[model samples]
Target: MKKLKNVLMVALIVLSIVAIAGCKNDDGNETTNDNKEVNNSVDSNDDKNNDDNDKSDTDNSDNAQEDDLSGLVSVSGSTSVEKIGIATAEEFMALNPDVTVTYESIGSSNGVKNAKDGVTIFGTASRNLKTEEKNWGLTETVIAHDGVAVITHPSNSANELTKEQVQAIYKGEITNWKDVGGEDEEIVVVSREDGSGTRGAFEEIVEFEDSLTKDAIIAKGNGNVQTTVAKNEKAIGYVSFTYINDTVKPFKIDGVEPTAENVVNGDYSISRPFLVIYKEENMTKESKAFLEFVLSDEGQMIVEEKGGIKVN
Candidate 1:
């Protein structure tokens, strides 16, 4: 009886030990599965964070590139282009605070010479490049179209003139306004000084190059011509269409009115190109940016606002 009881007790102890070992093994598997789930969650969160960080980096890079431009851009040339040039420079400088743009109102020929001599980044001219100028490796970019307005005093009765009539007046052939259908008054012809783009274009278009009468008064700039004509009832002069004001009246050429729309549509006969000249090889990044801006919609709007015709 005692041996039977002892055998039963030892069997019970072995069974308990086996059951405890089975429970421990099951707990170990559960622990390993829990650890794997935690690691997977951590990896997924890390990937999302990495993507967000990459996007942030890309945005910053783009901003840096957009705001990186800085330098000086110099433009020298046509006094006739002064108002538009200075207005453009003001707008460009406003947008690019780090850049400085300066323009000098030397005559158009001097503007070309200064650009060729590397004294300016851009040279503005109211006339197209001459054959000799094109041969100098200087390229002209026409930014705007302008009409050379034949202006006279408001009191003058003359409203229009043929190209031939205008040529005759400047050549001292027609000395009285009465010959051109105006009142009996002495015709006072005014012209621009030498190296003047306005004078160059006017002479070329009129086929009266080098034949301007010595008796004609020579003015320094477009404003001077406007002023001279305004002050003298018998005076006649030429200026950019941009300079036409209430003080002086513009004469129609061949019956076509001198106006911005007329200049753009090819109906105006006394029109010329407004140009910016530079060597392509010598173009700097700042200059390129400025040119691009001048051709932009906003820049062209400024051109129109300043009484010039937009070309681009």
Candidate 2:
């Protein structure tokens, strides 16, 4: 009986040992599986974070590319385009504080020459490019259309004049205003100087050529023409439509009123294009941006506000 009891106690001890070993093995397996799951979850989170970081970096790079514009843009050209150009430049510079836009109001011919010679990045002109100019790698971008106003003193009684009558007056054939339905005073014809864009456009439109009277007063710019006409009651001159105001009276050409709407719709006879010329291959980023700005809604607003018609 003592031997049997000892055997039973040994058996009990063996069983306890086995049960503890079994529990240890099961716990080890559970611990290993939990570790594996935790590691996989951490790796997934890392990959997701890396992808989000990469996307954020790409977006920042794209934004930098879109917003990073800075440089010097030079503009030189037509006196006729001076107001619009300067006004646009002012607004553009305000938007891009790092950019500098310079405008020189030389004659249109000089503006074209300067562009070809690389003296200026932008060449503004009131007339369309000539055939020879197009062959020289100069591209004209027409920004606006403008009318040439035949202005006289407000005191002048001439309300309207036909094209032929204007040509006759410039030709010195109609020296007296009475001939064209005005006062009997002698008509003082004012003309823009040679190489003036306004003068060129006007002469070409009127077919005046060399027929303008030699005694006709020569003004340097539209402002001068307006000034001269404003001071003299018998004076008659032509200027850009932008220059027309209460200081002088604008005449109806062929019965159509000289106005921005009329000029844009082709109803006005004596009108010309306002052009900006550039070498396409040599254009800089800032210049391209400036061109875009000029065609934008804000730029068009500036054009209209400055008394010019917007083409775009």
Candidate 3:
């Protein structure tokens, strides 16, 4: 009976060991396999996210390359070129968000001086450079053509004036409006001040020869001249044709109107060149690009829209 009991206990011990091994084989292997599969899925997802991030970075880099033009283009000179310069600069900058363009309207001669002195990246002149200015090695780029319009208060009766009459009025020889077929009011001659591009061109066209009448009221800038004439019914002033508004009447010169078409077609004789001057040796890349743009079809369109003659 004791031997039988010992055999029975050994059998029980063997059965317990077999059951423990079976549980481990079934549950532990399943947990390990599940963990392995989850790890692989997580790795796959991480790889996809990393690839997406890399592609995103590359796309941004390409976009940056396409719009990489960045620099300052500073243009100063010629109050008469104000509209043209501003229009072109604005459009250029809009296309190149990373670039900057600025225009400062001082005067034509000063603009040329600034270009030669390297004080500005570009300078504007409404008239051709003087012989000495050209001797300074500065180069001129003609952007557009402008006509000098002789304006008066809208109430004036005269619609046309000969070249000689316009010259005499500026020279103080024709002080009364009646002398020019207008009302008998005494003419208030408003002239642009010294250093003005409009004044230079007008004086040259009419053969003022530095002989502008001393009695003329000197106004600065086209706006100023426009204002002076618009307020005084007897006032007569000359401005860029672009500056003409309903506030003032632009007189016909020898039966030709001061229009862009007339100027480009060569019927408007009292015209001048609007120039952008620079030192070729010292020109920056940005200025060259801007000058090219100013001469381009889009640039000349702005010139025409601004009431200047298109060069192209």
Candidate 4:
């Protein structure tokens, strides 16, 4: 009886041991499966993040490449804007040596014509584009506001004149400076050639379009008009406000001086726009960048330094 009881106890102990070993094997498999699932999930997230980062990098790289520029840009237009344009070009070239910018101080009408015909990338005009010109799909950006100064030789005795009197003088009604309280000499009417932006603005402002005296001397540019008046003691002419130098004397109109401050305050009635024209649909990358720089704060500063009133 004792031996039978001892055998039963041993058999029960072996069964219990086998059962514990089975539980441990099942737990180990479940733990390994859970670890694999968690690791796989983490790896999948990491791959997605890497792909997004790669796409972001590509976009940034594309932008950086676009910012890199190199090419030639041609600008031509109003002689009035020539000095400012050249200064702007020089500064732009200094900053971007890879890009070459050239400016030609041809007449404003030629500049508009060239820009419309695609002969040049940019055109400068002292006057606003005509109504017919807007139909050509050309756009004008007013970069500055300038005054048309009524200038005379410093030897003249007249300090100022009424707007009507100035108009009459250009129209040949007041042929003698003595008629407007000047010397007894015959007024040497120095006028700009036709198609000159200065001429257009002056004629339009003075309300004497197509009526300038036939005997008036036609000068090609502002410098020429200044030169003519500078040497001739009896000469009277008009120029852009910037050209008002010691060589020539500026005449006040309607009790207001031809000054930047006067123009800004609307006291100067002979103010005109300085225009930069371009084609709306077909701007090159370099050309667009150049225009952006011209409108920038630095560019406007250059405009002021060059004796123009900033648009802003």
In model 2, pairs of residues that clash are none
Error of 2 at 148 (Å): 0.5
User: Residue by residue across 1-312, what tens digits does model 1's lDDT show?
Assistant: 999999999999999999999999999999999999999999999999999999999999999887777888999999888888999999999988988999999989999988888899899999988888988889788888899999999999999999999999999899999999899999999999999999999999988998998899999999999999999999999999889999999999999999988887889989898999988877888899999999889988888888889987
Clashing residue pairs in candidate 1 (N, C-alpha, C atoms within 3 angstroms): none
Q: CA lDDT of 283 in candidate 4?
A: 78
The weakest ten consecutive residues by lDDT in model 4 span 280-289
Root mean square deviation (Cα) for candidate 2:
2.7
Q: Pick the lDDT winner.
A: 1
Off by over 4 Å in 2: 1-22
Ranking by TM-score: 1, 2, 4, 3
* TM-score, structure 3 vs. true: 0.79
Candidate 4 Cα errors over 4 Å, as ranges: 1-67
How far residue 136's Cα lies from its native spot in candidate 2, in Å, is 1.4
The model with the greater TM-score, 1 or 4, is 1
* TM-score pick, better of 3 and 4: 4
- Candidate 1 vs candidate 3: which has greater TM-score? 1
Over 4 Å off, model 3: 1-66
Q: How far is candidate 4 from the true structure (C-alpha RMSD, Å)?
A: 4.9
Clashes by residue pair, model 3: none
**Model 1: how far residue 54 lies from native, Å:** 1.5
Task: Identify the runs in model 1 with alpha carbons over 4 angstroms from their true place.
Answer: 1-25
